[model samples]
Structures are given as structure tokens and as C-alpha cells.
Target: MLSKFVAAAALAGAVVTAPAAAFDKPQTTYKVFQFPQDRIPRIDGEFSDWDMVPESYVVGQDQMTDQDGGHHNPDKTLNIRVKVGWVKGLNRLYFLYEAKDDYWDFSLPGLHNDTFEVVVDADLTGGPLIDVQHQDIWKPEWVGQRASKTDPRVPGSLTHWYSHGVQAQNYHIMTPHKDKDWAMAWGSPTWIKNFPFANAAQSYKFTPGQSGTYRLEFYITPFDHADPEGPERSVESKLREDALIALGWIVIDYDDVKTDAKNGFWSLSTQRPMFGLASDLPLFKLMPIENAKLEARWSWKVVDMDRRLVAFHDDSVGKATGWHWDFGDGTSSTEQHPIHAFAKPGSFVTILDVTGPDGTSRRSKVWDVQLR
Candidate 1:
């Protein structure tokens, strides 16, 4: 039988270099599809695209430049904000990665269970790999039991930053599935890869119900493992930067896909690692605004002196290029000319931000608004 898992080094000291990736191109991948009838149902919530992509996440951040940092360039590290998208019956987050010459770690801080291990079998035309193995790693309840052996030491080990018990308060490794047989050598310094090593860090997401978002991350770097497993003192920061680029990463959401399952199998029993932080993020003003009923251009205006609803000839303003008027009240408006009425009359500071395609804008002033 083709082994469910491949031998990394003849189960011991034999190190075989990995064959080239068969399909260099990524698969047109999408997260698990959500169904309207599922557990949480695709109703009464907000969803949007992840604003950030997975970049190399450094473990030890003792300075502006970390010896164990992934991508040195702040501009390159992931700045996840999730700019746009709709949320639906999304259940869990999944991740698949190969550790050829990189240090990779997946950290899900506050896990709500509901994650899956995504493994892909690359069928390269001219490849030496005719077999592949897939398995899930579960967590053990031992006092301080953790992984001892490390793999993919060509780069550094990012897991050094997260130990099972020692990191309980700040962070902890994701426990694998119980039934699945996986392998990880844990120890003092160099466990996830090799001992006196620069520490590293990474992140992921998980969701308990089909009503949240999912996130994932990965990182890599040059390896230095002579005394077993740990960090090194290399000053060449570019290596860390190069490692980040070499280790491609991404984050995705799956709420629109329709699954026919009426009942959700969403439970925290599973040792799934990656998950969507389901706690509702405070809603910022939506760009394509919300509850406007209109899908086209909308505008609004306010007078500065009396903070009164000053009319700007609703139809007098030529087609506006761009504008922003925060009514300060819960309900805001912007159209050919927007007029908003607060639940009660009060003094409000109206901030208007306007810009045109020709790069021209004029703010009348922060109008002191009084409504009745």
C-alpha cells in the first residue's frame, strides 16, 4: 500500500531533497461553501474580504529587525484588514503547506475549533514522487508534552516561540486530530526544526459556526541546526526577507458557497487549528455605505454656522466625483444632496471630506449642527 505519509528521512537520518512542485500554478481554490439552511444560516451578519495576505510572520520581535523575523520589510508583512466581501454559511478555515527549505508555523490564538488540514497531492509530469502521505496531528493532554523532532530545517523553526504549556497564557501550539498519526520533535530551543535559535511567530483563524471569517499565515527563513534545534545569530537580514517571499501565503473567506446541509456540524470538539475570529469586529463606516437602498452615487451636505439642514440645491450640484459627510449621528447620508435627521435635536460636528477625479476638493468647514 502506498504509505499514507512519506518518509522524511527514512524515519531517521536519510535526508532526501524534495522534488520540484509538479503544478507551480496554484489551484483555483475557494474556502468551504456556505449554505443558507446550515447551522448559523447565512443571515443577520456581516462578511468581507480579508484586507491582508499571508506573509512571513516573525517569531521573536525584540527589535526593529529580528534575527528570526520572516519578512524584514514592514511593507511586505501582512496588513490584514479585510477590505470587502459578503459573509454567509462559512464554517471553518483550512491550510496546506510544504516545508522544503523554510520554517513554517500556524498559530491560532483563541481557537473556537472548526479547522481542517488541507493537503494537496502534486502530480508533476516528470516527478520522482509516485507516493504521498496525509495525516492529522492531534494534541496530547500530558503536563508539558510537545513535539520533539523537527523537520524542514533548511530554514529556521518558527515554532520555537510557542510551546504547549509555557505559552498557555500568551500562545500555544494547535493540537492535531487524535486519530491522525503525525510527527513533531519537541525540546528546549531547537524542536520544531533544530536549539539556540532565533525565536519566531505565526497566526491563523478558526470559527465554531458557519457565521464567521477565516484567516491563515506561513513563514520561512535560512536554517541553522548543528546542536539539534534552536535559533541562530545571522545578521544578514535579507535572508529573512527572501524567506518571506519564498514562502507564499494567503487568507480567504467562504460564506457564499451553498451547502445543502440544514444542520451544522459546527462544534469545537475538532482539533482544527486555523479559524475565523467570529467575535464581531466593531463596524467601521462601510465604503459602499450600508442601508442606503441606493446602489448608485449618493451625496449629503450640512451648514457650518447654525449646524442646520442648509439646502445645497439638491439638484444644483453637478454630478459629484467623490465625497464624505459623517452626520455624526448613527444614520448618515450622501447623495445629490443628503439631509439626515437625528433621533433627537443636538449639536453635532459635521466633517465633510470631498475629492474629485481631477484631485480638487473644498471642505466648507466642520459645521456645528443642531437638529430637532
Candidate 2:
């Protein structure tokens, strides 16, 4: 374990000394395979909408074997595979945990029960990790938390966010389960004095699929914790385009009997201390634009009192050499800039299509035009 400050200084140096191309490379390498969500899934234990979410990555951990071919873990059924997805619209990251188990044991006294931990590095651009170990120090960094199945005094589920060894935030009934409906009604900042810390605000839903496989979906909303007047910050601001982020996953199993002194544990994870020098961790990048939008421009002048012809321009986001315009009057043009005349029209919808960066298919946008 690197001393937190030393890690912070190293991170700061890396961010400052790093060259360009940090933005463009991740756009292709860590390209997030996300989908548009017409309706964000309710944080209930239902996962029907998750099927449409494109799977971005997967990491699986099964039981191990020794040199003698002996079973490393007796609980072979405790093995787990995690599937993850991302949706920029909701500013949420989803996860699915497929654990092979006959029964469910979530009654938690400690780390002895079935549980999962997600560690995220929100400082995609790289910086000194801030307020991680203690509230007094603010260095701008990443965070991690362990979300357990259930706790008696803590209602539905218990999630603990800590820095170093200090507890920063605690949430109860926030993690939804397959058997129960647990929802976070509000951004419960009161639970932690230093609210809005990086990776602080989060929501999750868990559902059991098939006989022994189960899935979990969750999201995080990082905010400015120093603000006394609380207001939710834009998650995109932290997860910037082309920026790199470190994500870590760990799943633990206890296999029945949640007792005072817990035993029987198996675990797996990515390298710890997710936030630091960029080279120190496995990083993922945020795409420049998940989907393309258009910038429509036109030059028109009145030929007479109530008649005019216009030349419409296709000024979309990315670099493009081709354009197709649907004038919405039983007419279309494939020119980069098209000239059209609207005769006797009240309202018309115009569409623009341009190929994306790949130059393979077309990306489109529409605008409503009103002529009087």
C-alpha cells in the first residue's frame, strides 16, 4: 500500500508532465459501448432495460487450484463473473454480478458474508487524490466503497465509503436487492459531514437472474464536497472526454452462516489504490461524443415580400466531408451545403445526416423550421 500523500504527489506529477494525445487515444482504446436510455431503469430489483445496455467490459474469478491439483477454495460455487455497462445520459455506471450459488446469505456482521466492492477513480485527467484519507486534506482524487448485502440495524443494505481507515460516508437501504425494493429517495448528505466527495452520491439495483446467476446495476454522481450549500455537480465534468479513469472490482463470499466470528472467504479484484500516476493503474477512457449532434446553419434573403430561398449548411460536431439534407418538402440534397426553397409552408422539419468519424455510416439530427 503506497502512502496516500506519496501517491498523490506522484499523480500530480504525472498529470503535469503528461504529453498531449491523452484525449484522443482513450477515445478509441477505452471506448465505452453505451446505449441511449429512453427511460432510466428504476433502482428497483428489476433489470429488463439492462439488456439494451452494451457490455463494456468483463472480469471473472473462479476457484483456484494448487500445484497438486487441490481445490484452493472449498466453496467452488462462490466463483463470480462481473459484467459492466455505462450510460452517459444517466451519468450512471451499471454492473452485473453472476455468482454461482445454491442459496443466498447476505446477513452481514463483517466481511464474512456475500458482498461486492467497487473502486472508481473519478479524476480521469489525473490529479492529486483529494480528501481521501482525511477531511482536512483536499488533493482532488478518487474513492472506493464496499456495498454489503444487508445489515440488521442499517435497513436494506449497508455501503461504507472510507479514506485511509476513516469512514467518510454511510448509506442505509440504498442498495436494492433481488428480493427487496430499496431506493435512495434523496441525496442523503447528512449521513456524511463531507458530502459531495468524489464518488459520493450513488444509486444501485440488484436482481437475480437464472438459477444461480444474479446481476447488479449501479451509478455514481461525484460532486464538490467542500460546498456548504449542497448542489449536485455534473458527473460529465469529472468523467471528461478522452480522460482516463481507473475502475476496480472485488467480490467476496462467505458461504452460509453469518456469525460473530466470520470465516470462509474468497475474493478477486484489480490493482488497489485506483487513483495515482496514470501508468500505475489500468485506465478506461471517456469517448469524445457517444452520439453525434448537428449544427444547422443557413443563409437566406427575401427575393420578394413573402418568398425566399435558403442555402442550408451542415455544421455538425465531427470532421465530415459529406452531407445529406432532407428538406422535408418531398426533396433532398446530398451536397455539403444544400439550397432549398420553402413554398407555402407553415412548419417543416429538416433533417441532416453526416457520416461519423469512422466514415462508415451516417449520423443524423433534425430541426423544426417555421416560415411565416
Q: On a 0 to 100 scale, what is the lDDT of residue 130 in model 1?
A: 8
**Tens-place lDDT digits, model 1, residues 208-306:** 222222222211122222122233322111111001101111221112123321111111112111111111001111011122121122234455434
| Residue-wise C-alpha lDDT for candidate 2, range 172-286, written one tens digit per residue | 2222232332222122343222312222222333322212554555454433231212343222223333444554433444344534322223322222322222222334544
All candidates: TM-score:
0.19, 0.47
Q: Local error of candidate 1 at 138, Å?
A: 24
Measured over all alpha carbons after superposition, the RMSD of each candidate to the real structure, in angstroms, is 22.2, 12.0
Q: How much is 341 displaced in model 2, in angstroms?
A: 25
Count of steric clashes across candidates, in order: 48, 4
Highest-scoring model, TM-score: 2
- For model 2, the stretches where C-alpha displacement exceeds 4 angstroms are 1-31, 37-42, 53-56, 62-75, 108-112, 125-212, 223-243, 256-281, 287-372
